[model samples]
Target: TDFEKEIKGDMLSSFISEVRELVLDNCKSNDGKIEGLTAEFVNLEFLSLINVGLISVSNLPKLPKLKKLELSDNRICGGLDMLAEKLPNLTHLNLSGNKLKDISTLEPLKKLECLKSLDLFNCEVTNLNDYRESVFKLLPQLTYLDGYDREDREAPDSDAEVDGVDEEEEDEGE
Candidate 1:
């Protein structure tokens, strides 16, 4: 029975706003993972997980009060459809660095009308011309686009090549 009140939990309900922005540079893996963050915090405004091995985030209850969310890096693949249905209050989302061959898997997030910022860095994103147009066509509230930036990392194109994007430019950008 090593379980006791050795550590007292903080009350997130009293917080004026719950904005958990976890921005790390480089986190290799989630080996030996432990308990997840209990978001009982009513004031939770923002939540970010940068450079962390966050594979799957299940049971994301409705956060009508949430404003911003940033989750970059780590080996997260699949189940994006489910994620889009949840987390309605997210305004800013950064999904950079991961194994994303097809971004269409994440189109579900377009339902988030409050979404403003979106980042998809080094995600093997193909068909940005099509994808970008699709997103712009769908999500009317989006403001800042991430991949189209000149400083964005270059992804290898297959047979066809889009203007304003070249292998040489990608090298410089990356």
Candidate 2:
């Protein structure tokens, strides 16, 4: 199918069968439905489909190894339960700039045990009174909401930490 070919063309490697990360940003989805994907992408760990006009995730394939998913800037309104079922191991999910409005719309995310970091920036839900508290209560499994935890502590950036370590090592060698 054309969808499969598009995914293949975007793959980092020529071998699409063993893709671990795929970015299809700005590509149009079939009316918010993803088709032509298969279990052959079993090794896929990270996927970014930003601005794809997705309205639902019901058609997403089961990706056991998936840890991070970027669906920011889409039209997804609800039905996150499909993510818990399809991307069971997902730890980080970026739904920033979507149409999520009420807290109840996020209730289904409780089923995702591995989910830790969730970003809902620019969503309507962020405007609710006590939004942070409500979301933390709803999804107890989430360690960080919009990059901060219940205590308002920011999540550590791995890349920055690695760079800091490198700088310290260079200083020690001086």
User: Best-fitting candidate, measured by TM-score?
Assistant: 2
Residue runs of model 1 more than 4 Å from their true location after superposition: 1-36, 59-62, 126-129, 147-174
**Each model's C-alpha lDDT?**
0.57, 0.84
**Candidate 2 lDDT score at position 122:** 99
Instruction: List where candidate 2 sits over 4 angstroms from the true fold.
Output: 1-14, 158-174
What range of 10 consecutive residues in model 1 has the weakest lDDT sum? 155-164
TM-score of 1: 0.61
Tell me the lDDT of model 2 at 109.
90
User: Model 1: per-residue lDDT, tens digit, 63-120?
Assistant: 5566766667756664566555557777667777866666566667777767766666
Error of 2 at 113 (Å): 0.2
Per-residue lDDT tens digits of candidate 2, residues 152-173? 8777782232111233333455
